[model samples]
Target: MEKITVTAQRKHRDNLPTGSVFGYLPRVVLAAMLASAAVLALIFSEVVRGWEATISAFAISWVVPGQALSLGQVAYFGLGTANPRGIDITELCSAVIIISPLLLLAALLLLMRRFKIGTVFKALAAGFLIIVLANVIRIVMIAFGWDHFGMAGFDAAHQGYGSAFALLAFAAGMIVFIRLSFGRKHKSQQ
Candidate 1:
């Protein structure tokens, strides 16, 4: 009779799936399912309903002083200005849209079994923070453009240059996730 080494047994267990479903399901299929579920949850959850206002307040405060955030309407107001130019933040402009896809991508990577769950989760967190910060910068840029120049400037920033920058930021985030999750391993010298 052969005895199994404790370390070898532990390694085998580590490679096994956490549940029976995960064990038998194909990785691609699992990734698709997880991605769909995550996106749907984010879309339907009230937990993030306040994100628009929160992001607006942060961006307004950073870009202009004494700017007040209005509730319900989801807009910002300038102090003492008769015709204060404010940006009305909507769900489309919120970071939720951008963050959702990135999260989906991360979840896909996790389910695909290319990387350890811990590593995927950490990278996902960092990527989310990066996306959120980029969104803030985009909002501030729009505000500054509107303040300095008007609708044309705002349009240029919002629809033209800003969109490109957003795409770049998102791509950079994806690249970072890929590098972190699939980084090359170096062989140790014997």
Candidate 2:
């Protein structure tokens, strides 16, 4: 029985999804391309910012503690706050940047892995959801910080823990990407 299992492992080794350091090249390249595209898009496209800012403002309004009024790309928080100024949804805070890594992984996985089409798509959807949700949480954190602690809290959440939160989200998305890509169930025979 053990011999038969060993034989099976040997036969399937070539098809195993995970590999060496170079395997991550797709992830890195995709991330860079997405980041570059984000910069270019922000510079050239008002339409992009229009939708993003609206989305950001609407989302904050839905969840923020105080009443929030959204206009254009800024979300104004009210109720006698220290910094009456609202938060602006900037190019840097684009969800495209947060989700680029996972989407790129999905694109490259098409060549590197023998995943079922359904599985690949599930990963893509899940990846988008994970990163987007994380970004929303980061935004909410900033809003909450600003609402409570004024500019100091805002700075702490945005400059201090905001980055760390985003990094953790990226790490989490990568982990999910690996698991979905390498789902160790019966091969779909694709």
Candidate 3:
């Protein structure tokens, strides 16, 4: 049994010839090409399917939190009372759109080991919660804008405040990760 095991090990080592350039560049290139293709396909689909309304719906939904939050914002501000332009802003479809990118970014960072697995995951959870809270705030701001300054103000809040809120969410995630890393380091030193 020992002799047989030795023979098998020798064979395995021999099969992988030294200095044989099994390059990873080709695989990396192929992966990048595929990712680019997928992104292009998604963009094309969105463009072909009425991009304007699709984008607006996506952006609004992400910044509006859940159903109850949205309803409360609308009721409190008295903005979506009669439905503007026959469009109900009650549905929360954009949350998925906004959260998907952040989740993907977090997963990629975790997989790449940019941070510890546990730390990255916890940071991602915190980030998601922050994003939800920010979204609620954004909704309230937009509702108030619409109530006071009409469509122009609503549009401005959607574009400006929504972007700021999203950035805040991202910053929150990074801060969480950094804090966890620092805490871990400090504990190790002690």
TM-score winner: 1
Model 1's lDDT to the true fold?
A: 0.68
- Misplaced by over 4 Å in model 1 are 1-37, 40-42, 45-49, 188-190
Q: Sorted by TM-score, highest first, which candidate order results?
A: 1, 2, 3
The local distance difference test score of model 3 is: 0.48
Evaluated against the true structure, the overall lDDT of model 2 is: 0.66
Q: Write the residue-wise lDDT of candidate 1 on 1-190 in tens digits.
A: 9864566546876878676784646655646765886687476534453565566666677666566575652556455555476666566766677777876887668665557767776777777777777766777777777766779878998988877777788777777776777756766433
TM-score of 1: 0.72
Tell me the tens digit of each residue's lDDT in model 2 across 119-187.
Answer: 766766776677777776777778878777878998999998986997788778777866886666766
Which candidate has the highest lDDT of all?
1
lDDT of 3 at 122: 72
In candidate 3, what are the lDDT values of residues 114-139, reduced to their tens digit? Answer: 35556655766776666555654565
Q: Which ten residues in a row have the lowest lDDT in candidate 3?
A: 66-75
Worst lDDT 10-window in candidate 2: 1-10
Clashing pairs in 3: 61-94, 62-94
